[model samples]
Target chain A: MNTLSYGLLSLLSHSPLSGYDLTLRIQPFWPAKHSQIYPLLSQMEKDEQVTFETVAQSDKPDKKVYSITDKGIDSLREWLSEPASAPVLRDELMLKAYCVPLVDPSITRDLFQSRLEYYRNNLQRYEEKIRKIKETSDLDEGEVPAYRDPLFGAYILLNKALMSCRTNIEWCEWVLSAIPQDHT
Target chain B: MNTLSYGLLSLLSHSPLSGYDLTLRIQPFWPAKHSQIYPLLSQMEKDEQVTFETVAQSDKPDKKVYSITDKGIDSLREWLSEPASAPVLRDELMLKAYCVPLVDPSITRDLFQSRLEYYRNNLQRYEEKIRKIKETSDLDEGEVPAYRDPLFGAYILLNKALMSCRTNIEWCEWVLSAIPQDHT
Candidate 1:
């Protein structure tokens, strides 16, 4: 199985989640579309890595909720033992940033301004999530969850997201400041 | 044309480059394989967005050095005016991080330790490049290049890379600290 398949199994290891819930939960870590995820989930079930139950919903159509099997946990342990592949980041803004000399200074300013807003919004969301996690968990101020705790993984991941988001926001503001206020 | 197509054009706007050079230069911003890049260059040439000339080398086989056409510049300008699509970051380590509690603490420590090494290597490379840029460009200490300068884009992009790398390194160290020293 590919990294995404292993990623799906990783999420299921925490708790059984519907495919929709899995889709939402996996976004910040690994962005995969529904089309890609559904087929992978089906293949995983066939391989006995994961098993799903048809959960009936009153207002919506039935959904498949998947849980990791023993086989899945074994696969995850194997995958974890291997070195993870390098991160791949494809940002259209970076490409644009490379050619900023071709555009107006105002256009350049707008590009970074909007990106600043994007990061700010994400910062707010991540902060809210981390605060919620703190409220729910027994974590003390400046204290991390124990390695075996269920919240340990989520705690660290949220911290990474927050750190990265704030870094991007800072970079965007720096870029904006560098741009001239008016086209000369 | 896809975003990669525009990305290639964006790079060409700075200077003409061979497909091999393009593949190498784009790696820091958009990681693409030689197989993927050569085919895209051919397609871009067919669409008249770029033109190429065979440059013979004494030690190596002749290569096609591509230069952006007026059409390519127009395309890049159009792309720059539009808001960039959201960045896509697919990091396998993050997936593994989300399931860290499943593995031994030692295993988790190894994962972060290796990632820390990776970021350190990158940090060194970026630091060296930024140093070279500073030495070559007319930029003063803590001064940014003008928007119209050829080095402006590279300058900002490198700063972003450095900032992001340092942040990641900080994160890995923090995670490693959080993990217990001895398995309980």
Candidate 2:
């Protein structure tokens, strides 16, 4: 199975979740569309890696809630033992940044300004998330969940996200400061 | 045309390059295979966004060195004016990080250890690159290249890479410290 398939199983290992819930939860880590996820979930069900139950909603149509099976856990363990592939980052901004000399100074300023705002928004979201996790999980100030705790993974991942967001913000601000102001 | 198409043009805007050179140069910002790049280069050529000349090599086979056309510069300028799309990051380590509890403590330790090494290696490479840029560009300590300078893009991009690498290295070390040592 592909990495995304295993990623789905990884989320299910925490707790059973509907496809919609899985889609939302996986966004910060691995971004997958509903179109890609639904087909993979079906294939995973056939492979016995995951099983789903049809839950009927009163106001909405029925949905498939999936959970990881023993086979899935075994697979995840095996996958974890192997070396993870290198990360792939495709950012349109980097491409644009390379050609910034072709555009006006005002345009360059606007580009970095908007990106800085985006990272600021993300930083706030991550901070709020970590605070909520601490409140709900009863983690004390500067305390981390135990390695075996289900919240441990989420905790570290959120910290990573926060760190990355802050770094991006710093970079964008640096770029903006470096840009020459237009006198016209 | 796709974002990758624009990305190829962005690199070519600086100077003429072969498909092989483009593939190598784009790796830090956007990872693409030669197979994916070759066909796109041909398509870009067909669309008149780029032109190429046959460059004969002493020992190696002749290669097509591509240069961005006026059409390509117009495309890149238009693209820079618009807001860039959100970055897409698909990291397998992140997926594995979420399910760390399923594996043994030793396995988790190895996972982060290897990833830490990967980031450290990248950090060194980026440091060396920035040093060379400074040496060749004749910039003083803490002096950044001018916005109109060709080295400007590479300088800022390297700084971003250095920042990101250091952040990842920090995160990996933190994760490693959080892991409990196995005492059998």
Candidate 3:
């Protein structure tokens, strides 16, 4: 099964949304191109996991807004309950690091420095996002915090990303220093 | 160009080896399936990057030991010098974390716990490997450590994996604690 299907299902379970809306929601973290999204939505519709209704527009093309069906929710819940597989890491930096001893030491140092800069920038961005999530998740006056609230999961996900950025930055720094000044 | 081609070139630069030997060398870190390797070797041979000679065996099928050409070495070096791309992360755990709020909190908690155990086990394995690398890299008397020695790169790679495991375990622990004790 397409994993993007599950991501869309989670989004649609919140509310009926057009393909554009789904793309926008996922772009903040897990980006799916419109080309990918539209096709997947079509497949899901054929599979009866989702259904769409065309809504007319005054000055634009009609939009097909999609919502998750009962089947979609059941599928999403089941997958979420199962154990996740080991991540397939396609990390280019790690690959480069593996081969760096064969190249110039100066080049490897530059690569580590470049990666450190990237991760540090990401750290700042995720930290800001976590702050925003905390503010958004706070209950307003007369609002009830339910145990089943899905926003809690969203909160944890952002925190995990934030932690990941921090980890990457620290790892980059350590690798940079550990490389000998006259490394082969 | 096939990414596996570069990995093979890096391996063969150390010494001439058969396909089986190459697979064994990479299995500890950068694993390439035999199905994938044999074909890529054929292609690399056609590209004039690697050459092979058949060796007869009495007790088994004849082996084709392969060696990298100067062209292959140049190609590997060129690619390593270029800037590495941002990693394409396909982390299933992150996906599950994103949807956990839709499932039972107990399930989410269990996911975090399972992930913690995996990282912890990985941490121990990498730690031992790091120790072994240090021992191996230590030169005996009259041995020269070349600046271009690939062992240096291999050492760094192990360190990077060790750091990654540490980062993952720490992230899992933080997420576990941040989750409310009574989450639904």
Candidate 1 achieves a global lDDT of: 0.93
- Across residues B1-184, which tens digit of lDDT does each residue of candidate 3 receive? 5666787887787789999888877764555689889988999999989999999999999999999998988898898888777765656677666666677678878888998998898889887876676678775642333446667566666766777787788778877775668744
> Chain A in model 1: its TM-score?
0.97
True-contact fraction for model 1? 0.89
Query: DockQ score of candidate 1?
Result: 0.89
Evaluated on the second chain alone, the candidates' TM-scores are 0.98, 0.97, 0.81
> What is the C-alpha lDDT profile of model 1 across B1-184, one tens digit per residue?
8998899999999999999999999997889999999999999999999999999999999999999999999999999999988999999999999998988999999999999999999999999999999998857888999889978999999999999999999999999999999884
Candidate 3 has what TM-score?
A: 0.83
- Model 2's CAPRI class is medium
Winner on lDDT (1 vs 3): 1
- Backbone clashes in candidate 3 total 2
Tell me the DockQ of each model, to 2 decimals.
0.89, 0.78, 0.44
Considering the true interface contacts (CA pairs under 8 Å between chains A and B), give the fraction that model 2 also has.
0.84
Per-residue alpha-carbon lDDT of model 2 for A27-46, expressed as tens digits? Answer: 88899998999989999999
lDDT of 1 by residue, A1-184 (tens): 9988998999999999988888888998899888889989999999999999999999999998999999999999999999988899999999999999998999999899999999999999999999999998857889998889978899999999999999999999999989988875
- A52, model 1: CA deviation in Å? 1.6
> Which parts of model 1 have CA positions greater than 4 angstroms off?
none
Model 3 chain A poorest 10 in a row by lDDT: A139-148
Give, for candidate 2 chain B, the lowest lDDT window spanning 10 residues. B175-184
